[model samples]
Target: MKARNRTIQLVILAVIALIGLFTIVSNLSAGPAKYPQVGDKAPDFALAGLDGATHKLSELKGKTVILNFWGTYCEPCKREMPALQRQYDKWKAQGVEYVGSNIGENAITVRGFLDQYKLTLPVWLDQDQAVRKQYGVSEYPTTFFIAPDGRIAKKQVGEMNDAFIESALAELVKK
Candidate 1:
């Protein structure tokens, strides 16, 4: 009887091990998930800014807004900050707004990075990471060009220069 009990225990253990191995293998076979596509309604989000105020995507509904998702640690993001700043300076007078959403970073760190780079654009801190997930931003630097009607005009997956920004802005900005 004891031998039969030991045999049953061993079989159960083996089955559990097999189940675990199968789960791991299945997970490994699954590839990376794809992000959201263009033409989708830009997800509404509210995040605390570096200035201690909160910013919501729904609040800025009338004007063309550029939503840039970036992190300080991303080299490409740091590289493009200057160009973005220049574009913002030139077009801000024309009622274009550029917002940089810092993903998964503390406000202090983001503030320091902005100060170091002398970036004056409004930055929203997505510390909770909910907005990042909402926007389907798996990468470091993704940009969404929002039209005056609050729909996504264009989706840029990587770094953008002043010319690229200007071109995108020109399409959305009304004359």
Candidate 2:
């Protein structure tokens, strides 16, 4: 009788372990899905920039906007800043707005990074990852091309060179 009870206890423990593993696996894989697809309306979000200024997505309406999500620790995110800055400078007068969402960093750290890179584009600090979740961004250096009508014209992931950036901007600028 004791042996049978011990066997039952072991079986219950194994079942519990399996259930825990399944829950963990499912949670790790689950996340907010991507939404900045082409032709979709650019999702609106509000956050504090590195300069202590609040920016709302809806405020930049009637202009072409490039919404980029990046982080301080991401190598590719750092790599694309220079090109993005250059693009911002070139077409800024042509009605292009460049907004950056910094994930996983505080305002001071992000401001230092912006200063270090001489990036003049406005960067919003997403310290709590709320904006990132709202945008459904899963990776660093994800960019959305928002048109003058507030539609997402394009969505780019990973590091992109000046040519690709310029091409996307050119398409959005015509509006």
| Top TM-score prediction, candidate number | 2
TM-score of 2: 0.78
lDDT of 2: 0.88
Over the stretch 52-148, how does candidate 1's per-residue lDDT look in tens digits? Answer: 9988888888888989999999999999999999988888888788889988898888888889988888999888888888788888799999888
Assess the local accuracy of residue 68 in candidate 1 as a C-alpha lDDT between 0 and 100.
93
- Per-residue lDDT, model 2, residue 163, is 96
TM-score (all chains, Cα) for each model: 0.77, 0.78
Residue 135 error, candidate 1, Å: 0.8
Shift in Å, residue 18, candidate 1: 44
Q: Candidate 2, clashing residue pairs?
A: none
